[model samples]
Target: MKLVLSPEQRHLREAVRAFLASASPLPKVRDGYDPQVYARLNGELGLSGLIIPEEHSGAGAGMSDLAVALEETGAALLPGPFLATTFAAIALTRVPDKELLTGIAEGRIAATLDGTEVSYDGSAVRGTLAQVLSGMETDVLVAPALTGDGPVMVAVELAGPGVTRTVLETLDITRGQARVVLDGAPARVLGPRPEGGILDRLCVAVAAEQLGVMRASLEAIVGYAKIRVAFGRYIGSYQGVKHKLADMHCKLEQAESIVRYAAWAADESPAELPEAAALAQAYVGRACFEVARDHLLLHGGIGYTWEHDAHLFYKRAKADEVLLGPPRNHRARLAQLLEL
Candidate 1:
């Protein structure tokens, strides 16, 4: 399949990048989630429904489109309750929940994962979850829990009765995390987990975001190298610095290709999506983390300080490296997927 992004996808990326550059500059991002920005993103940009079908108040976009948006999100390190809501929108298609689905598209609903385990006792769920992303403000929570048969999906409202929430500190302060306790909370059964590709597609989207992180870090370092002089010459002119930049660029390019293909696979090739996602996570996670870390070193003393944005990117890179699962795990899964 062609690796290049389609015209619409390119336009989407540009639009998102431009919007984020203005709306989510480093300062605003450092302040954490902005309700205004989140509203604009979902309402004006229609990002809240990028992947949700039109019938569900979305843009009728696919995973590929979402990837394009996510790349920019990563570049800007945009924060909010976006991830969990986006995931819920995509994952809820299996179940018939028009109101909740439409709420997600409208940005009125927010969902996140903490740690949740529940059983379907006919009409409700009973369980607890910890470290829910942005759970403090989320309305719905989507997580996998065990049932009589196997692992099933549960969509519960955080504001409803029999629910408890506790905000927790996280390295990525741009996004909030919390612990949620559910005591026979009312929930809707989505479906079985393994059979659904919701989590896998989520990983693909995350890979695209990490790819942006790597690209941005490389660009930052390269830009700094060109301007910062050492020993009467530009640091970038040094053979060592040049080599590191070259290697970083090479890895980013590789990451781009794999991420694009995984996005494409998510939209068009379901059978191949698991393997494609595995490959993207395995490579992109570690690749982005390395690029960010090296970029920090290349930035000299300024990067080490909290004031600079370099550390921010580095932390995001590291967090994303194991957000879903570590590269080592994905690598193992990749080998199994490829039968290697």
Candidate 2:
């Protein structure tokens, strides 16, 4: 099937790219590494309400639109809690409370999910989430906790009595991640615990962001290879280099197909989402890191330096690859899905 984007989607892509070019340029990203910047940007761009219905002050766009916007954000390496915030939006959309939804959409508050846990008592959630993007800046924490029935997502105010946050130093400088400590934090349950299709959709949304990061890393490598010469010739002209680039191109195309299918499935049919998301994550994770490493090698000594941007993409790709689930995990899931 042809996977071309519609004209409106293409326009949306262009608009987002342009917006990032001006508002979140590479230098700007380097400068604004704080989590607070993400909240401001989300409010300014109306990104906080992407998934909420129009009546709740959201854009009411589908997964495709969100994916398009994320692609540009990845390209720019714009620092903010885009992934966590977007995922939080998805969770919030399920809530029937119009006021809560509107609060999130208007950028008056920020939210992120604390999905990781080591052990939990009935009253307290205590664990360290490794890669909680924008955890420090968020005003609300949407955490998945155990209830009498099953796992449930609860929204807790960050300023509550027993919540403590610590910013963790990360390789991905553009994005912030932290460990959260919840000591009997008061929380309001958002819903009856996401399961089945809804959980799959959330996973697909994360995969889509990973795919965007991979695509951007691939392009960055390709762009660098074309200009950086070695032994009096462009490195891209060499057979080995050409083959590497070619492999990256193939992997990227495959990942794109899976990501597109996953996003569409999230908006259309949830049954197909798990397989699509798994495939996308498995392929995109490896491809993104490989491309970044290849780009660094092409830049030779300059790439290994601190001033270069290659490391930024490389680090982010590596970290994100294992965030939700590693490639091996996805592969196992895929095998089961295919009944292999």
Candidate 3:
């Protein structure tokens, strides 16, 4: 599998990065999402359609391509339904729905996966999800519900009756989250319960986003260090500061490699994806949080203030660390996978 990004991938990354730099600047992100900007991202840039099949009016791209877009978005902290929609799209791939897929690709629908336990009673779905990503903004929810026979995946329209979504306050205010309550909500069964396939893909996708966070945090500190003066010398010149920066850089490098490998495995090496995903989540997850923490610390008192962007990175790091499961949980999974 190709670990290195191809020219096309590089071009896509650059385009995404440049577009985010202009369209989703930090100030814009802090103000919250703009529907127009998101529409441009999906319709003009085609990020939402990156991984959907060409038959569904999507690019029919692979995980690597999606990874590139996610990394750029993570760096920009572009708040909206992009990540949530991507998760829903990925889940939908396992249980194909031409209409949903096309709507997602065309930026006509926003979706997310509900990580709560809901019960499916033959014809209806009932449950209360404490938290759901983009829950307030999404049009559709792909949730796993328990049925009489077993667990099954279902798609429920949020606009329908018997669905209540309450916005929740979270550390990462950049992303919208809500408490979703379903009372016998109408739902369409997708397929049998997803085992490791969906989880692995989610792990890899989040890992890639974490990789971008790590790199951006490192770059921010490094750039700050070059100009910040302390005791008649640049702060970056101090041995202690230099060493810490070097360590962050090392972790960033390792994270990028792991994320790339996981993305590659998802696209071209299906058999190796689970292990690669576990490794990516286990290592990159914790590393990104650490790097984000150091990024705030290295920036001095200013970093702790509400006006600074360092806290944003740190918050995102912490949120992502627990988004799927904590790094410790993934480490345990990795050990089990190896039968160690």
The local distance difference test score of each candidate is 0.83, 0.73, 0.91
Name every residue pair that clashes in candidate 1: 113-132, 114-132, 115-129, 115-130
**What is candidate 3's lDDT per residue for 37-144, written digit by digit as tens?**
899998789899899999998999988999988998999988999999999999888878898999999999999986687999998898889889999888999988
For candidate 2, write residues 1-340 as lDDT tens digits.
Answer: 2256889789878877777777777767777555555565666667767877999888898887787777777777777766777777877666545656788788776778666643335555555566677887677877677776677667777778887888899777777777777777776766666555545656667666666677777777788888887889887799988898788788778877877888887778767777877776767777767766776776779889988887777777787777767779878888999999
Candidate 3 residue 122 Cα shift, in angstroms, is: 2.8
Per-residue error (Å), model 2, residue 330: 0.9
Against the hidden reference, what TM-scores do the models get?
0.95, 0.90, 0.98
Cα deviation at 320, candidate 3, in Å, is 0.3
Largest lDDT belongs to which candidate? 3
How many clashing residue pairs, candidate 3? 0
Off by over 4 Å in 1: 113-115, 148-151, 191-194
- Model 3 alpha-carbon drift over 4 Å, by segment: none
Clashes of each: 4, 0, 0
Q: Over 4 Å off in model 2, which ranges?
A: 34-44, 117-131, 149-151
lDDT by residue (159-246, candidate 1, tens digit) is 9988888888888878777878888888877667746686678789889889888988998898999899889999999999999999
Residue 286 lDDT (model 2): 70
